[model samples]
Target: MKTFCNQEHQDQAVEAIKSLVAIPSVCNEDANDGTPFGADIQHALEHSLELCKQLGLETYIDPEGYYGYADYGEGEEMVGVIGHVDVVPAGDLRLWNSGPFEPVVKDGKLYGRGSQDDKGPTIAALYALKAVIDSGAVFNRKIRFIFATDEETLWRGMAQYTKKERIPELGFVPDSEFPLVFGEKGLLQLHINGTGSNTLNLSCGDAFNVVPGGAVYEGSRASELKSALDELKFEAKIDGQKVEVSGKSVHASLADQGINAIVRLAMGLLKIGEDHPMLHFLAEAVGLDGYGKNIFNGVLEDDVSGKMTVNAGMLNIDTNSSQLSVDIRIPVKISKDDVVAQITTVAKEYGLTYEEFDYVASSYVSLDAEPSITLLNVYQDLTGDTKNKPITSGGATLARTMPNFVAFGMVFPGESKTEHQANEFMVIKDMAKAMEIYAHAIYRLCCNQK
Candidate 1:
């Protein structure tokens, strides 16, 4: 592991992360042959696979571009390291000190969109495997590094890969924090639809998993809404018959930390008229709290993953119809069906139709389990940080897509989380340390004699 951690490999890992980040592999809704997530995403995947080949690993890309994998060693039982190259869209570029796609290192931190969320960690894991291979370690099982392009959006790439490829017996995803994550809350995306008037046009948010930073509403109550915005101290302007409100954007998983512009605009409109369907929908159904207490009677909490979180991530309204896109992270013990049923009943009461567009079940890997204990021990031994125990997260990672998988770190304890935020970055030194940790974890999990 020390040999693999040489300055040369660390430098290579940093360079790889920068190259991948420069691609701007944001997933697009448009789909075509060999480019299910658009051409740029495909190019990113191909570039990464080519890098794997250059490292002397056997690599394969799915014909339809759903996913790709770089393999090391040869055996029946496989150890999977799942990660994604796709990154969330860079929001509000003006907030960044550097271009989101132009990777740069300043003050010892690499600044870019996917620097911490995944691209940096993915490269770290690759070099870790390279280290293991270069060390000439004996392997009890093959190691496969699975790369998916749709993780930021739908996870359709992983879904397609699992159907056509082999599932690993045990593995971990390097897309979370260092202490290790044992449980992840279930993810549910609900679309609340209804017809509305008063507001002729409205729009906010590009993705259902991001807290909207700004929104525009054109209606009869523009002046009133502007006054409300001023009273609320929200940045806003009134132009003709439209009002535009600006707020801070953060990941939907950490919705509490952000000021949702869509929610604020809806609140302002409610001051004008409570009967407006769109306004009432946002006020009564969505509410201000990230928790879904106002809408579902707050019946969604558990000991493992704590309380559920709801984010009104996307909203749109016109003269004829309105649609509100809501993203929920449900507790592990809560049943998705039960939560959806409660939301349906409440949505109907507001004269809106409830439709769940995407769902991924909660995942829990026992702390006492072999894979869990093994990875935890590795982190504790390497970092000398034993105070932080295995934890649960509201964020979903590729770990939940396969059996016996959990999310291990690239994020260190107490580090500021920049994922899905403007001007995201990863500490260069931390990334190099992650490479060494990942290398040791891989050797222990895949190579050490039983």
Candidate 2:
């Protein structure tokens, strides 16, 4: 067997990642009037298909508007390389030293939203396939290269896409940890409502999936609250023009970006004791004590993903209704029934109500399986560090939607998470290495071997 490893292959991989990262495909919000989640998903799919065509890989977007894929051959067994182009809204550009979609490369790191999340990895996999095709190797199985747009919200894109397409006999997604992901915890989203304290006129957050960058509340004492909030310079705007408070809205995911006019006017005066029904409700969603951390430490500890994560993503209050929106991610092993029971019980105790309007279960790629082990072997051949085992995470990818899919590396070690945060990026060099691995794995899988 002749092995193909060279510099020309590496350059193509880098260019592929760069092209995909250039698109601002934030998937946080659905298209207006049920236009399919994340308005930009279609654009991303177009870009993906464009690359596929340029690389001479046969491609199609399927009937579902969520995803598309490029193929390499015809065979009984299909190997799908799944990735998502839909990205979380870059929270707080101010936190990011670089533009989210500008695709900045510095000191061996590329920064932007979806760079580390999945786009970068997706592109890397594309180039990996390119390298295999360029290497003059023939395979018996077809390579189905798919990139999804709805992985972050739920696996709907891949789920619906696969409903019409053939499932791959064995494949791995480059959207999660490397060296094999043996187990993945289920993902859950809960919305806690009715905590909007009438006493405080305004409150809001960044998004449903991230920790709120900031929050604010104002009381009937408008003048007093205004003064205090102005002193603190909180985000969001609150105006008292007609004997009442008017709150202006800001992009929820980017709270740290800056304080909006309404929130700035409402914060500072109100304290945590203001009887926030939403605050209490959110705390209880992920098994946190609903009475705030003072009562139960306000944190869920998990061995796999580390700490149970919670983000106070949204807060709304009006004359007729009040609600608080929170984002919580826990280890996948927790039972859905238990989580629902625990949250429902807590809401009852707090005299508040809650509901889970959104959720995505966690996904696991068993390392023991051939799909995982072969991919891991490909990486080990390149780096030789075997300690980094595939681990479960609160973060999810396109793999979660498919039965056999799992996220592999686009990220290595010593890198901070820039997914929902700011200044997200991936190094050209590191991304090249990832493609090299993908090429090896895909080649092995597609070749006339078993």
Candidate 3:
């Protein structure tokens, strides 16, 4: 409960975050010997590891660019703190007040693409370890800080790292909100395929994990589609043969908060032709609803986690073939197999082929567990806020890859949730407080109490 973090530590953490945000480490398909996730991500990884080395910690970077880690202390047992350096692509840079890669401080907030999603928290964690080491605390266990590059994509970095490196017995990922995250819903990405017609050419969305904000369509029946869109009060533009629709973008895990432009455009197209396979499939299977009720039976919910969410995040259609990329978050109690089976059946009924990939199972840690209890106590003691209890999240984190690992705090309670959104920013004071909390948590778990 003692305060180990000072203004100096806070300043160091802020500078580190700024340095990292200056690098646009968005994942790319370009692969090479040392840059599997492209050169930018590789640079970010090396920069972070070098910072660790500068802090007098032993550092290691995987040769294949899967992951990297920094270690402090010497002991038989180890504790881990995992975070990702790669960020999602900044969509439509015009939406941001400042450059997405350029870190800007205004009104005591750090504004950038990865500021809140990861870079800020990652830097805070490194400084937390530094504080513990500076305190001259004796440790019975080693503390390993892991940096991953592909968390925004398929998480191939963490997957490969686990196969080649050591897995900590107990750890926490500083990727989610505090008090603590005891449970996370399973993550599933599905691709639905169907034959395309000569009616429309369409494309929308950037990633499967984010709702589509705008879609462009070029085809016939422009007047009919325009009428339908106007009736719904949705944003749209019709010019000759091309039509564009705009909707709000949000994390696919929180699909309910977003109005998917892909679905809205499909519905408008449906009013033009009911028999259009791609449009009908989207309207009937995906629909405007976020619950996948009409498509995959009913909404899946549980007492432990919550209701399931489905988002048609990406869509493409042309004269040859069409594909719909979907992201679904299943509650802890639901089985992925069951959901897949139902979706496959529905897709087949619509003459669309369905295939699911990138499956991450739900993770849960009992409230009675020592690690959970310790983390919660540290958060409560640091902030003097004990009313907020541990909760479940729809977003999956690296915590699901290893046993006894759960997502701790980087995001604070009542803060704006802006991960994977335009103009993302982190409160400066919250970042400092998170550093303090992480410092105490790391010290308590790594130091020898006996």
The candidate that achieves the highest TM-score relative to the unseen native structure = 3
Minimal lDDT window, size 10, model 3: 28-37
Which structure is stronger by lDDT: 1 or 2?
1
Per-residue lDDT of model 2, residues 1-450, tens digit only = 345546776666566667777777766453574446645667777888888899898888755466788888867878888877887776556567878777777898877777777877887777777777887788889888877777666667766776777788777778766665655555556665563344555545555655444444444555555445455543334556212222322222222332233222223333323445544444333222221233234544466544444444566776556765654455655566766676666667767676886776666666677677777777788779688776776554556666766667767755444566556667777777677777788888887475
Cα lDDT listed for each candidate: 0.86, 0.62, 0.87
For model 3 the TM-score comes to 0.96
TM-score of 2: 0.81
What is the full ranking by lDDT, best candidate first? 3, 1, 2
RMSD of 3: 1.8
For model 1, residues 99-170, the per-residue Cα lDDT tens digits are: 999999999999999999899999989988887788888888889999999998889999999999999999
| Full-model lDDT, candidate 3 | 0.87
Who wins the lDDT comparison?
Answer: 3
**Candidate 2 or 3, higher lDDT?**
3
Order the candidates by TM-score, highest first. Answer: 3, 1, 2
Model 3: runs farther than 4 Å from truth? 31-34, 219-224, 238-242
lDDT of 3 by residue, 104-183 (tens): 99999999989988988989989988888888888788989999999988999998999999999899999999989989
What is residue 207's positional error in candidate 2, in angstroms?
Answer: 2.6
